[model samples]
Target chain A: MKVMRETIVSTARELFRSKGYAGASMNDLADAVGLKKSSLYVRFPNKEALVPAVLDLTLQETFGQRDSASGQWDDEFVEVIEFIATTLTDRGRCVGLHLAYGTSDETPIAKHAVRAFFQAHRDHLSSILSRAMPVDVARDIATDTLARLEGATAFVAIFGEKDAMKRAVRLSIEEAKNAAAAKSLSSR
Target chain B: MKVMRETIVSTARELFRSKGYAGASMNDLADAVGLKKSSLYVRFPNKEALVPAVLDLTLQETFGQRDSASGQWDDEFVEVIEFIATTLTDRGRCVGLHLAYGTSDETPIAKHAVRAFFQAHRDHLSSILSRAMPVDVARDIATDTLARLEGATAFVAIFGEKDAMKRAVRLSIEEAKNAAAAKSLSSR
Candidate 1:
């Protein structure tokens, strides 16, 4: 029964990633899971109830072990971009982006969950950059870098332009390196 | 009759912007426009057909005369960021982004329309940057800048942090200025 619940949540995550919050109906979830509507309701009660579980699974899968042991800021930053690029180029679109755009005025729970996820992502990036620059500069660069990444993911998702995503990643890493270099020079 | 048709398209655009592509059903649009489902179908034939008209209206409203006669690249760039920032912060979310993310694999027409809109937006930004720097550098910067704008807009839309959007715009403009200055120095 526990395994079944896990499977259901993971499947629902995929559905949400592909169809978005509003687009993914409970009936669709039931159909995807090969369960009767009543059985699906028995498990999740309602669509909104499943959001936390789905988000928990997403947080685990995407953001697990993000810290780098090597402590190389540039390498860490590139890894972040590569992870985003892979998600965008691959079949699975950015789940957070889809949820961010798909959650309407009606779904406050989903909205809050999505917001928390993005905030955490931004904070993580900021922490990674802080190792190389001042806290404020790192925060700003992290915010800007995350925005560029999210934007590039949107472009890739919308346009199916993998090359554009690649270019954005390359440019983002180069910009980070330049910023770091400039900071070092100023300090010297 | 034509005015009513235009009104329906505009209202549908709003619906699409808010509810998303898949989330906005024909019944909902019919109700929003105060028309029967049959009547709505009489005009659009189907939801897919509405994608083009909806996108056409969006293109006209958002991208119209994006070209600046002032010929000052920095001001024009800031204008672009301001436009995006305003859209994200305002009640009306970025329609293109909603369409881009809300569109599922089933909705090819919606997908194409979204792709075209983003491509045109990128091209316009690139053209603006091209005037002040090397074509390749300008193109890269334009792409990066657009990605940042889109990402920042997403952040504002999801998190409702207007200040972050403002900071992103300020940073983007400063970066553009720095890039322009660097180009002038290199050329000399």
Candidate 2:
């Protein structure tokens, strides 16, 4: 039963990633899962209901269970940014970002899930940045970096320019390093 | 008749912005436009056909017919970034970007329209930045700045952080100024 449920959630994630929320129908999910519409509904009451599960799974798969205690801030930040850039620009689509933008206030649960994922990402980035700069500076840079990465993903999807993400990642890392170096220089 | 057509296109743009490409159906558009499905088809042929026209109108409305002849690169760049940030984050949605992300390879015409819009934006930014720095440097900065703004829009929409756009705008402007200043110092 657990395996069956996981299969449905994973399949739904792919469908949502490619077709989007409205584009991916319950019938399509059922067909993809090789189950009847009734069976799919029994597992997930509706399309919106599946969103939380799908997003949770996506968050886990994309970010994993890694902690930010690596103590190597630069390397860890690079790893995170690289992972995101690669995943987001891989097939020229970011399922998480796409779904987040597509979600409306009408789907509060889905919106909450989307918010949670982004917040987690932001928090992760802030923690890493704080190692090299003031807490507030870290927080602001983290937010800015995340936003830049998200925007670069959109550019990749729209223009098919994978270098856009590379540029964003490079610029973000350079800025973070410069901030850290500036702090050190000032303290000296 | 032209006014009615304009009304339909504008309404469709709102729907696409709010609900995304897959979410906004032909039936919904017809209902919003107070036209029968057949009537909507008569005007547009199909939902996909409306994408190009809607995008063109959106580009015109969002960007207008401004040329980049302004020698004041810093001010001009700021204006463009501020305008994009305001329009994209207003109401917490960017119709052009949302449509672009939601577009699929199957919709070649729609995809082309999205690419063209972003390319025009990049070109505009590049032209402005070239006045302050070397052309190559200006081009890279323009691409980087635009990605940051685009990413900031998604952050604003997802997290409801209006400050995200403000921060992006400020950072972009600061970076452009710093680059211009550096070039002057080195040349002297």
Candidate 3:
């Protein structure tokens, strides 16, 4: 049952990514999931309830693997960004981010979900960056890093150029390193 | 007549920003523009056609003013980003870019419209940055700058924090300046 629920959420997430909340239909989700619309509703109640479930699953499935590695912080940082880029290029799994940005002004649920996700992601990134720089500076770099990566992901989605996002991520990492170096130099 | 068309497009753009393309109904647009749905179609045939027209008007209205001022490239560059951040925070006037990212995958019209906007913006930015650095480096910075600004715009939309976007823009401009300085030093 757990596996079945995960499958349903993952499939819904994919549909949401490509078709958007307003564009994606529950009937299609039912068709894709190999269930009748009635059965799907038995599991999810309605589209409104289903979206948050899908987002939670996305958080777990997409970012859950972020903590498994034991490499150096720099390697981990790059790997984390690479994972996000890979997701954006591979399946446009960042659809929740898109929905959040698109309709959060009118939808409190989406606003909360996306804001929590971004804040959590920023906090995780800041913790890693703080090891090499001041906490305040690290927090700023983390915010900047998330903004660049997220923006690059959107650009790739719009333009279909993988390299554009890759270059942006690389430059952001480089800039953060440079800022850290400059901060250290000034301190000395 | 031309002024009326511009007013309609600008008003539709605002509706699209706060509401996603799928979420922004034709009725809502009609109401926002103080026109009946039938009259709105007389102007735009359909919502699909209306979006691209709105995007073109947005390009002319937003980025059109980019070249009117004669100032140092650095100041102009920062000013452009500030302008963008201002738009995102001020009135949420960046709905076209949002549409491009959100619907471009399934809609060819959206893909083309957004691609053209991003490409043209990058080219314009490249022209400005080229004055300060090598063309190749300037182009890279231009792309990076666009990605950052676009991403920061989305960030502000999602999180509703104006300062986060503002700080990201400032940092990106600073990093670009530093990159130019480093390139010059290497050449010297």
Winning model by DockQ: 2
Q: List the lowest-lDDT window of 10 residues for candidate 3 chain A.
A: A101-110
lDDT by residue (tens digit), candidate 2, B1-188: 33388899999988998898988988898889777777887678778878888878877875686665744778788888888888877857877777787777888888788788788778878888888789988877888788888778777788778887888888889888999999999999
What is the number of backbone collisions in each predicted candidate, taken in the order shown?
Answer: 0, 1, 0
lDDT of 3 by residue, A1-188 (tens): 23398888888888888767777788998889888787887777667666677777767765687774367767777777777777887764367566674545456666577677678778877877776788988887887777777777766676666776788678768966787788779889
Local accuracy by lDDT, each model: 0.76, 0.82, 0.74
Evaluated at residue A38, the lDDT of candidate 1 is 78
After superposing candidate 1 on the true structure, give the runs of residues whose Cα lies further than 4 Å from its correct spot: A1-3, A66-74, A171-188, B1-3, B66-70, B174-188
Clashes of 3: 0
Clashing pairs in 3: none
Which candidate achieves the best TM-score against the true structure? 2
Candidate order by TM-score, decreasing, is 2, 3, 1
User: Where does model 2 exceed 4 Å of error?
Assistant: A1-3, A185-188, B1-3, B182-188
Better candidate by lDDT, 1 or 2:
2
